[model samples]
Target: MSNIEIVDSNISTNSEKSCVFDSSINIDEISYNDFFSNYLIANKPCIIQSNATKNWPCKKDWIQNGAPNFTLLKQLFGDCTVPVADCNKRFYNSQDKDEMTINDYLNYWMDFRAQNYPTDSPLLYLKDWHCKKEHPKMSIYQVPKYFASDWLNEYYSGRTNLNDDYMFVYIGPKGSWTPFHADVFSSYSWSANIHGRKRWLIFPPGEENHLRDSFGKLNYDVLEDERIKNDNKSVKFYDIIQETGEIIFVPSGWHHQVWNLEDTISINHNWVNGCNINNMWLALKNELLSVMREIEDCKEMEDWSSHCQLMLKASHGMNYAQFYDFLSFIAEKRINSLVYKTPNLSFDTWIFGKNHNLFDLRQIKIILENFVEDAKDKSIYNLICKNDEVEMLLNKIELVFQSCK
Candidate 1:
């Protein structure tokens, strides 16, 4: 393991603070090789120190006097229309969100923080603003080496159909927070605090059993739940207080809830790579199953699978065809880098050449093979397998993998 360390805090009479989590690991200046081998491959979470974002302009330009620089931010991105969520209200399993100009949100923030404003107004949180896509001029930070091979963003760049990217900016007041949930697609995510502090309650895989009720419903709030505080056994979760400039790597499938200790702004990305692609696929299957169960009565219909696929696309963001497209796109890139002698090898894959390329190629091939075999009834398998483009890419990948041996 990559230097495991336990981090229990001083306990008071409060039962909530009684038992600490099993371990908390922090690394500074971790090399790409060490990061991949120790945390990525091991599917473990860790906090990397502030070296990654020390030089980011946001660290200075976006902060002033231990708070977010409202004037500077307005001068930079005031006119942009962005999505803001109502943190006090939940709708459709997430916070209610709408679009408004950045200036309007700033006005709300300023009013909310000033004296006794209308306290009944919901806490508006600026969530999931596509920082890179909307404002290409802002080069705040580079994708860290460990997280560069982001298939999601790479696949959807400038495409009309899949225009959305995973890179997001989150800004909220002191009481604003995200509810308990795993990342979308069960993807591994890294969050960097640029302005203020955040308190994170993270539950590792399988530990969520304690938080789930008998009916399989999860508790909305961890700190407020008596069951969580009372359960001294069968569950141990990390209580992390992330400070400004620190990065937290949340591994695939980990459930976490976050609270802003101060008025906070952060950059976060959800990524899928070779290490956690399997988990992503598994999460899709779970989503599909849930969708099917919801409309199980319609199973007798002839187009039931098609219905499931449509719902999957709407609910999970990608149907089988899109999933295949993502895999094929990534596979073709790897194959080309291996065959065409290009310097680009898909994000952080520059250092390790043919061996890593071949390994990733073989992994993609296996995932494709498994998906095809498993989804024989689906239209995507037939559409993808019979299509000349996908077939040619698969053949090229196979040839590359074979020649490497």
Candidate 2:
């Protein structure tokens, strides 16, 4: 068992400390290439200031009088069971999580708020709700152009095994928060505050070592961790107060914690593109290694490798086989699009232009090639290569790239 800490959610004393971070580069608009070069590839966080999500119906329907419309939420999603996090309770290094219907949660929230959200019973925070699929008719928000090439959501959307996606809706009372952690798969993420304000504590990669305990778990309260501020004082951090309607870009591998400065609702997405696909691949490999180590004592057991692979899939949401499946699916589509010269049917062609565009077929082929080369460096690639479909797809990817050349 790990050390569990019961924290008071409403501590605002940390605001008195001096915190310095580069004011997020505010831009009215950005191009795909510029974003890729300066931020995605560079792995730098920024904030894009624009009225990009003003048209989202939730902005008006889900909020009233500068706070979440609790009555509306109960009316709309009363029976919908949601994953709620207890913000004031820590289970190891993360918040204790539970599930309750929107109605039940709102009922509890109403009672809690009326009693001023007591330190016990935990602050119920509805995190990662799949609002888009549940209410497809509701015109929410559009994904920004800079972070548009999202393979995770694009591939998963076609499969029913996981209808949920990187797109998420987070609703919580004031003081509800997420603990410090990096985005899964080392992927980049962006959060657009739909309403209310959030205080974000973002630390660039490499500095997380200062905060993680010997067990490799990050501290729950990043802002108030004295071990980080007084002991290993070299770690610098960004304290950002994200306002409603503003989108905050969290670069690949940046560890962050978020607190609802007021009753808040936000839409967030975790994404991977050619710019950070390598990082995603690396993260997957690390996950596999960790899975292997966990079950190493059973290595001599029958089908141990297969068991490890199974655990990898269950733990990380995908295994090497699924990775190959995703790669093959995208590569085959792109190859067919190139072979048929169908620009309209080709996402790469539309976004990157026919040739030498922002993300052309040829550029995609190169990324696939790089990924394949990197995958080959992994020991598990041998098992992946043993699959007939994987071999065929690799050959097809090569043929398509050569033909384009």
Candidate 3:
């Protein structure tokens, strides 16, 4: 565990406050429009005021007095099994993960508490729980208006092809830390701390390029790596103390590490929208190319391209087809909105009004052009040609995009 101490408001001085909260933006400092134009569009990270999640129900249901409501949590969700990561040990690139019931996790947490919070390594942190999937009717928190333009969840939740969403709940005790990494698919993510403080070290987008060592391997822990600090003096980051109720808007490609300064619970959502869809496509292309290189000896193997896609999906949790489906899904919705002169009824994701819909459509068009060129270069051009619906969708998207312009 890192040696950073939690900033106590009563005991902390102005210097300590500046060190921890230099990156914070008061919630009232910016309206939703300012948030969209400044943070989301600019692809930057910021700690919004706790007021963003101040009114959330989880503050009441999940937190009792000043501590986590462990009793109620175990009562309602003890049966739900979640993957817990051992922070002290690394299994190659990531920590060792095991599945356990929420009940058992809560018990382990309580036992850790009873010991008076020892300086222990290897804290067990429950990483990602799709509790919304388990309890669909519960209202833990409403999505903040600034982040309501969440295309990723909107697509995953309504998909008939799969039952999944990126909404997640994270719970962990003090000293539990997550290693540095970018978000899945390089998408934007927002994490709201319902209770307890968190220490976050977030590096900007291209900082990752400097993080890799001579062997082209990234360090598992940025804080502990001497070479990373010595050799890459230019790499900068934001050290933020996210107090309880604060929501952090993490933009695409910003690699970050987080530690629970106390027993903590947070709601997180990984989302993609027109703003960062290009990053998503580029990530897929780069990952696919890397996978191809890994299995280059199998170039003569049957369906080698298909095998590469399968491996990509297995490793990255998504393939080009699924990504294309995501594009097509949003494209259809935006196209329908424009063609029928109808506003997007899904209020949570529709931003900037109808003209913003046009911008999204145009953004998709730009990516679609790159998608085709990449397919042809990869020798999988037939993947696009074989799908009649994809071709027609492309045509319709182009027409709508032009007409709207």
Candidate 4:
């Protein structure tokens, strides 16, 4: 990449003090009311001065042997450039193999690096290369459970149920150099750097113009490049270099760009609690709005009625599942037409084109309002609708037009 570096002393310190965490400083040590009120619920980012896997026996006893452990992890991780490995026939060997340690191995694979590992090596390119099955000894999702049992017991005392919408991402070196953008997913996230270091540049949401009408989606890469050139103007940015045993909480919709500074390992959990339910609902509403636009677009086409009739005939006597698949295909065509277009009309102008008059804003509003209300009340909507409301609405509108014909 991009050699843009923005450092924030608010999050970074050169203290040589080693932060140690054990059962004594578990989640119970911090009061839930205080923690949630002051930190977690507010979407404020904090460094939990504790080890994520302090209670795990494997992590405590794991040795940094250069052969079997390193060899096995390499086999599991595959080849990647940031980690710098060469293929020795079917197997791959790292140039830094001799310097492998527990910290180094953990750092190398934990950051987003594994995904960016050079694909040339057969050992790395296999689909199942990095796949790890859940086992009694090594349960992937159970890491949170272990933390709850050991550290978070006190803090989780009042919170009866924890939402499972969170994601656990382990990013390593060689991982994709993420562009500056906010997450479209409707949840806040907690990122813990278990090993190595990462540099982060963050900006508050809504501060930057998305420029989507020109580029379809937000052009984060271009935004990042521009931000770097104008850095002297004191634009909002934070550079975080988290070492082993630290956690950083990132709120939803905050624009952030992260790069692995070295062989790094970090786990991120994206979750939503009761307080953030409104944000999630708004995200859903945006999806519905997009769908309504597509439905309107499909209705404006000259052959719209005929196309819908043909599709309906194709789905005649088919099961609900088959009908849905066919409908999805129709929806995809409308969405694709919107996304990939000539330079003649911009996305916003194209969306408001004269051809979109057939469905009318009133009808589009009704469909969108109905979908959002239904989603909030019954929590039952088509999967395609949940994933992308615009496509589903377009397909459903086509079906309605076909019925009228």
Best by TM-score: 3
Tell me which of candidates 3 and 4 scores higher on TM-score.
3
Tell me, by lDDT, which candidate is best: 3
Question: In candidate 4, what are the lDDT values of residues 210-296, reduced to their tens digit?
Answer: 334364555444333555556644455455555555566566566676665654445555454333434544665565444445455
Rate residue 20 of model 3 by lDDT.
Answer: 24
Q: Write down the worst ten-residue block by lDDT for model 1.
A: 4-13
Candidate 1, superposed: residue stretches over 4 Å from native:
1-28, 116-121, 158-161, 345-352, 377-380, 383-392
Quote each prediction's TM-score: 0.87, 0.84, 0.89, 0.48
RMSD of 1: 7.2
Between candidates 2 and 3, the one scoring higher on lDDT is: 3
lDDT of 2 by residue, 1-405 (tens): 111111321212112222234345544555555565567657777777647667767887888887678888888889998899888778877878999898988888788788886777678899988877788676766666666666677666655576667778898888898988889878889998888889887887788888776888767777677755464457877778887888888988889988888778899888876567667777887898999899889988987777888999998988877876776665555565568764322122233233322133434455456556655775455666675555566577667666766
Q: Please list the residue runs of candidate 4 whose C-alpha ends up more than 4 Å from where it truly belongs after superposition.
A: 1-29, 57-69, 72-166, 169-171, 174-176, 210-216, 229-234, 300-405
Clashes of each: 0, 0, 0, 19
Residue 287 in candidate 4, Cα distance off native in Å: 1.2
lDDT of each: 0.75, 0.71, 0.79, 0.40
What lDDT tens digits, residue by residue, belong to model 1 across residues 118-202?
A: 5577888899899778877766776667776567777776354766888899998878899889998888899999988898888
How much is the lDDT of residue 185 in candidate 2?
78
lDDT measured at residue 251 in model 4 versus the true structure, 0 to 100: 62
